[model samples]
Target: MSIDWDRRHCSRKGHITYAPDEAGLRNRLHASTAVGTVWRCLRCGDFVLGEPHGSGPAELAPLVPRGRALRDLFILRFLAVERVLRGVLVVLAAWAVWKFSNSQDAVHQLFESDLTAFRPVADHFHYDLDHSPVIDSIQKVFDYKKSTLHAAAGLLLLYGLIEFVEGVGLWFAKRWAEYLAVVATAAFLPVEVYELTEKLSWFKIGTLALNILAVLYILIGKRLFGLRGGHAAFEAQCRGASLLEVEVAAGEAGGTQKEPLPVRQRSSTADPA
Candidate 1:
């Protein structure tokens, strides 16, 4: 089923109605009813009750997003949310790594004591602590040098910061943020693939897929890197969604738009009875 992105956004954010200085366009966008005046919402092109949100020249009208533009914004915000989550999670992981590095000795001692305590019980159940995969994983971490652990933590923190920047930029729909996200995501694809090669997991696969999709969607849909006529074309697509821009473009192209018919009046008496 098709989604009405325009109406969906308007429902959440409320209608954005404008009164243009140009009489022709203004009349087309507003109307008088028995109750009061209503203005046409730029976002949904629907007449709404009450005064307009803004009054200005046609050129000064707000570029309220609709249709595919709204959909694109929706997708970008979704990616932004994902980026924010990644930023938070990685930052926490980095902190955990740093803390673990600082208290390695204490942690190692505690693990040994606990393992010793569990040894008799494990032996009774025919479970060998020495060969346990989970225990081996922890022991291997203890094998890392303090400096190595600190370095790993630093890298994670830096990556988290980058993700945070991407998230904020994308949430605001900034062009530079789109470029940054594309580059960062593309650069990580190889690492993600390599990880999958080492150990196959659903979480890893899903993250990789989302990153890949984000990169492609931004690059192609946004016309980045001269693809699909680049930045100019992208801006043009955005402007096309604006009614004022459409009227201006039509004027420049020598095309005339037909104004809407006037509202009908109900006759008090029967017609020519």
Candidate 2:
């Protein structure tokens, strides 16, 4: 009778076909028969297979999870710099708002024509001397005078709060955090670009470029922290291999009355005692 390989061991009967491994755990093909297959084990990271006789037969790639050991150090440096930059931005913005609010004389000087003539509207406000067509246009869209400092303060605080939250989430490798960071950073890009065009300064240009880089880094480099297609495939391959092993072991044990197969085991540097 032809030995039914299908009915023979754990490796043959699975939804996904596994290659044979000879150097598996303890190296016994089957407890009774010497027949077996060879494969690499992902768990133990070595050649794995049965001896001359064994029941379970499955092949797998040795798993070696790769990551930069110094990656966290780089990340720590990035956060430290970011915190300092954030503090400076807040301080500058706050000072600008405060300076613009209480300085009536400076406001008048801005509207003064040749340091002498005030516009017709200056008679009404006394400080409209500095008002120009640009200021007039800005006022028409949104007023930000001394009286509205409280409202402006609230808005600035809200903006800073959102940015701070995004930064914290990004540091933790959370998927939702990455998404939030991407959205928040992207939302500011257009406005930043406009500011860059309006005035080409080191500060403005640098801020715009930094924000753009942050957006791209979050969305592309990390795949939004594994919310992408590649991550799904990687996870699937890992889990699929695990499930295959379990099924093969159960199948081989049920099929024959022969003794369990012997397998070879190896020690690795990464393994713990």
Candidate 3:
């Protein structure tokens, strides 16, 4: 009989009151099963004595081992967190641009009005107004056209949206998200490398390394761009040591059982007097 492996809970049997916890069930089954045998249901937590026929016992057919999936999920979550932080930064940048645009007139007025008074304080601090690149840049920003500020804010918002989308998609383990992340991250590598060439810093190096690692992990581990036999090979690997496959192999090696099979019981501890 064909089984819908996607549905984890046993609806007809009503084994569990709530929805079946696949992770919990997997741990229980892994601990219960013998070294060479596969006998527990990852879905419904039922013991499999023989091939499940007419709902006798739900077969164990995990798409991937829980341990490996957990690790992959953890990596995805880390990437998601990074993307989310980037999104927030870009959003804050957009807000900063908006605020600056609104307050530039006041700032310019204040700078012009206080130039005489500020120069004494600047002199006291040994600051050179003629050679301060930071002050020059601030003055240039304050003089920038309104259209340019709007365009900058728009671009920042767009980039923030993209980062937010990538974070949410990766969090859900979507294949499209993996592709988007890899492409977007790789696209920034050239710019990052150029920045590194301009100025060397540990922060820049670390950021570059992280992006490279993320790209590599998505391409190799997720089997993107037909690497390592692509998705088909990945799927096969996931199903290789599955419970259903093992049971089928065992049945093919031998004949069908006529009587009920013996259930392996764990040794119990004795109560002390």
Per-candidate local distance difference test? 0.81, 0.47, 0.64
Clashes of each: 0, 39, 0
Pick out the ten consecutive residues of candidate 1 with the lowest summed lDDT.
264-273
Tens-place lDDT digits, model 2, residues 21-52: 43433333223325555533333223345432
- Select the stronger candidate by lDDT from 1 and 3: 1
Q: Superposing all C-alpha atoms, what RMSD in Å does each candidate have to the true structure?
A: 10.0, 15.3, 11.8
For candidate 1, what is the TM-score? 0.87
Q: Over the full model, what C-alpha lDDT does candidate 1 score relative to the true structure? A: 0.81
RMSD of 1: 10.0
Candidate 1 residue 146 C-alpha distance from true site, Å? 1.7
TM-score of 3: 0.69
Candidate 3: regions farther than 4 A off:
1-65, 111-116, 250-273
**Comparing candidate 2 with candidate 3, which one achieves the higher lDDT?**
3
Candidate 3 lDDT tens digits, 78-186: 9999999999999999999988788889878898778757888999999997678877877788778988998999999998999999999888777789899999999
Off by over 4 Å in 2: 1-84, 91-147, 225-273
Ranking by lDDT: 1, 3, 2
User: How do the residues 3-115 of candidate 1 rate in per-residue lDDT, one tens digit apiece?
Assistant: 99878887877888888887767766788999899887887778899988789766556566667878888898899999999999999999999999999999999999998
lDDT of 1 at 226: 96
Model 1 regions lying over 4 Å from their true place: 247-273
